[model samples]
Target: MAVRSWVNAFAVIILSVGQASAESSSGSLASSVKRLTDKFMATGAEGTPPGIPAISVAIGRDGKLLYADGFGQASENRPATAGTIYMVGSITKQFAAAAILRLIEKGATLRHGSTLLKTTTPVSSLLDIANDWTLEGGPPITVAHLLSMTSNLPNFTRRPPHELDPWGAVPAKQLLGGMKEYRPSGYPGSFEYSNTSYFLLSEIMENVEVGGSSRDYHRILREELFTPLGLSDTGFGGDSWEANRLANPHYRRRPRFSQPDWLKGSGDVASSVIDIFKWNKALMEGQALSPQMRDLMLSDCARVDVWTYYGMGWFISHKDGTDRFFHSGTVSGYTSYNLIVRPSPAHWVSVSLLANSDGVEGVDSLADELAELALKS
Candidate 1:
């Protein structure tokens, strides 16, 4: 209640000052900026410690950035500035989606019945698994399913009864072979969240691109999507501290699995709020892909049995009598959300919250709070 009151007061003051400035040419732009900064700082100071850590948010209308701000620290006691870099987590799925779309535009074969079991790759065992990978009376696993997280492949890393492994740096084939051992839960077109499916797509993409490493595939994204869109701050690098330019992960202080680098294509990408803003712009403006390819990436790919409206890589929400397209990411201690108002697809917003915190519950609470705040804002 206090925060809401304060925001209302601040907005009124800002509007008043702007009106006064029109009458008297004495107010400097710096003064207006200072006032805005102070307003944000006041809200953040009152909102922090559990409110949200270092949020870098970019709100846009029609592919143009209207608001961008970074609040809190990149880590405990460390300030997060405009330059901080944080892991975008499952937001990496968007990049993977775009990359696969690029392959499709280039005529890579990802049609029905594209088997991904590798003969020379690390998971040589999955070649056997591929033998039985039928449609199960429906469509086979296509590249489209992989991009949309609809393959419903059991996450080999997080199988129950046994602790999920954080050491995903194992060769891609090994990951698939391990996944083959898990029991099936649903069919190919079923919508389910699984990092393993994206990693599997990454393996197949590695083979699709000529003489390209997965890193190369990502670099292609950097050069094509990010660079052209002015998202230089977003990238995948080997250093952990690179994420400091973004919010640090928040988690309760508990023993948790530590991730390894081999998980690169799945969730190892580092990015900034501004970079994602540029990404959203590029995606919506059709800068990175042809119009048809862009539609395929955003189109509904599958249906979630759990949620009537949610499907594939995106979540569905209703506000003001409209449906919103969005996705959220969580890894270890960090949680983030990306949402774009759809149909028009004009307004977009993303919030990234990081706590050196733990436990899925706390992280989820933080993400939910941040998302609610974004919706209201």
Candidate 2:
């Protein structure tokens, strides 16, 4: 589960996990809702992935956190809790997207030098792209194309002769530079998920030598998005993660997911359920970007499949009558999910799930179950 940056689902939070429900704030969840969670999420998962032993969930409605809880164990003795931190992999993309928009909104032109960076601007204009890459017929990839996942750039992750070793933690610049060698694998207009597209976007952002805008991605995120939004608990792995109760990677080797360098703007951020809920509320309520840019970011920029559309950092899809805007993340020893559902413009609900193990699909399925019940209740 790299990400659904889609994460595979896992079991519900009803288990032998330390704090399980002892410290959970479940008053807002109706008895019926709890029964529904107990019925579906009730049992099915035996905590298969030995590495993935804990799952935490937080729910928000109308603009407030309605419920927050954890299931399973953080370690042999430690219990996963609402405040438990997990490396939210590609969920980091959302913060990266917000940083880009916020920088643009702060009167800083989205350009590094001669190029006037706008949504319509081509990738060739921003970075020193390879000459061989081509659409073969149509227009070249643009800022909007990259943001919406229409840039058919090759994904180095799935390759026969890997450009950068998928397991090696390279820097963002190295990843982007490696992408220069690969020609366009598909047309520039179709939906294709590529981390290189975002690496390029981050480079473009970093190169924006404006009045005082830092060239660093992490610094930009901390200054522009996290600090301004009051998200103190959300930060990069190696930096701010250890200060809190962290869900360590659960593999036999038990290596940490600390190397986010190559994954910089792509899938390298850590956070908690409570902090995630606050982020979703602030983002959807227009506190993140101006209404115009926010709408564009959430707009159906490109279709992912039959139902899902790729927006800037989120996926937009529909179930029954409700519209959902969300993203998920997966890293070693971790899996994460974020969701916002609109039953109507006036009604809203959000859910954030983080698990310590991988290979479990229940995490994704559990999110669907919880979101549906929350919307109805």
Candidate 3:
């Protein structure tokens, strides 16, 4: 098992590039992208233990692919390609959030009394607080709460070191039962990101849908969110993806870390750069979701800080007087980021960067570099 300390360098950042002319003007930006990509691979290739085998990057500026490249090999034996798959860590949150919204579109609402009650799986003791769970906390724990991460539940990621699982497997139900009994760290209105809350929500989704599986919800997403949006390559766990379309796993201070099967809904979806770009375009164009649902996705769920804002399932940034909606994911050996500017739908861009090494360490810095290059050009 490998552990990431979430050091200062591992933060994910999203920067907005003004609506640059979408003409044939990515030459200089392409060069900068190459420089950043080169820098990352250079460090990894020359690491003390020699970093993982490869890296793949896709950058979209103002809704266009300014640059996409593959560095190193996608697999230890196979050469990496532009479409390689990568484990997009917590970035899976927003996608899960989007799936929840699809349920709402189907007439299922996240009301006060509605929750998943009857499932054979044992719930974790930590989640017992949700047992007597009424929707009394501020705004009822709607699918939105799970999305914005303000349901007042504790984020399992922030748990004590011994309790957190870098690569351990505990029954999902056991973890949920534990959370059920545990008291929330803050009021519902307070901003607290909890993977436990989403886990519970995933269960509830299972109850609402015909089949009791988060995979079913993803199946629905395929129709409501993915297919219509042309995101053929985006899919939940257990899919047969193209060999050339998957990024090899990357780690830091460790050789390999297998992701837990139970963490599927929280962060186990596999995706490609082109797939995310298509998803971003659909989300911006209101193709995957209704205009109303789109607004709900951006609606502020909680205020994390004076500068950083959060909405249902997405992060909002108000910089340079422009508002942007975005999210980032960090999974074992992988780091991913996506951001799209509102109002200026054409000003949409998504970045998917993967390395066969713990590349997320440079997420924020790389995002900054990508944005600067894209916007400046």
Candidate 4:
């Protein structure tokens, strides 16, 4: 996890030369981005893990990739690069949410030909648990409730010690079957972060249709979001060439293993810093979603606390009079953070960070700091 801060002057010079037009267009903000990202990765400090085994960062301003760089080893032998893929946990939810919105835009109704749109469909129509379980007179959950993490679904991670392997391969059916033991605590409209809600959403998307026949969630995402946005490196993890390029996952300096297939839409997408930047830019440019859908995705639907709100797949916050949309993911052996700051109509800045080791101090802080720096620049 030790990282040597040897600046790649040659690479910088080449990138600067190649991006002269972009620099001119951004009016010196590009230079500021480059300077800030050059120091983005942290050298391990006391109480923190030695250093990030592999860290990749990308900064975008006004829908342009201003700076991107990688540090440390992607694997045992491979040096980190802009294309080194890492499992980006809950950030995958954004793509899933986008796919749902795409289906809605295509005029897809809920299962059973219900007139309800994607957001209004009741959870009972999609999954068996909603019918079998009761919430002590609470209202039935809806698609909007799940999307906003207000479904009051029981968090599987809170299961007894025997079920604490958050990254282990648990079948989706098995996970759902066990939910009968617990009852919903919070009301349907109250905020409760639940991966199960998204997992069920994934299931619903697979069985329902937009235009004609039903499609798998992964296929829907690929066609509607990744392919259109040119996110070539992002996909489900498995024994594939893309998987081979994954920066090895680690926890406390020990190598961690890969996740199973059942995570699906909740947290099972992998991508590099550059592709993530592309996603943020596509979002900003209205390429991935219509203007109304984009507003819906970014709108604050449920309050997480006094200062934070949960939108469709994003956490919305405001700092110093600027609006921020962000999400962080933590699975076994990996942690990631993505931040987008919209300070003005003409300015948008995004920062994406992927790290191999779990519980790494400063990963989130570094992303926030870089976003702030990009905004100021």
Q: Give the number of the best model, judged by TM-score.
A: 4
What TM-score quantifies how close candidate 4 is to the native fold?
A: 0.85
Worst 10 residues of 4 by lDDT: 1-10
lDDT of each: 0.53, 0.69, 0.58, 0.74
Q: Candidate 4's residue-wise lDDT over 233-267, tens digit each?
A: 78876626433468888876443224464567788
**Per-residue accuracy of model 2 over 1-377 as CA lDDT, tens digit each:** 11111111212332223222323255435343455434433453564433457777887777756567666777777777777778887788788777777766664554445455578767776678645545657777777777877777776555512555655566666767667777665655888887766766678787664574446777888878888887766887776444337776665444432454666777778777877888988887888777788888888888888999999999999878878998877767787889888888888888888888654456656677777666654
Q: Mark the regions of model 3 whose C-alpha exceeds 4 Å error after superposition.
A: 1-27, 43-52, 109-129, 134-140, 158-171, 210-215, 253-260, 341-346
Cα shift from native, residue 136, model 2 (Å)? 3.0
Ranking by lDDT: 4, 2, 3, 1
Best by lDDT: 4
Q: Which parts of model 4 have CA positions greater than 4 angstroms off?
A: 1-14, 17-47, 110-116, 132-136, 160-168, 242-244, 253-258
Report lDDT (Cα) of residue 248, candidate 4: 86
- Report the C-alpha displacement of residue 41, candidate 1, in angstroms: 12
Superior by TM-score: candidate 1 or candidate 3: 3
By TM-score rank, best first, the candidates go 4, 2, 3, 1
TM-score of 3: 0.76
Writing each residue's lDDT as its tens digit, candidate 3 over 121-219 gives 112211334545433443334445556676666566555224546466655565555555555446555777666656665665654542333344456
Model 2 ranges with Cα > 4 A deviation? 1-51, 107-112, 130-133, 160-163, 240-244, 252-260
lDDT comparison, 1 vs 3, better candidate:
3
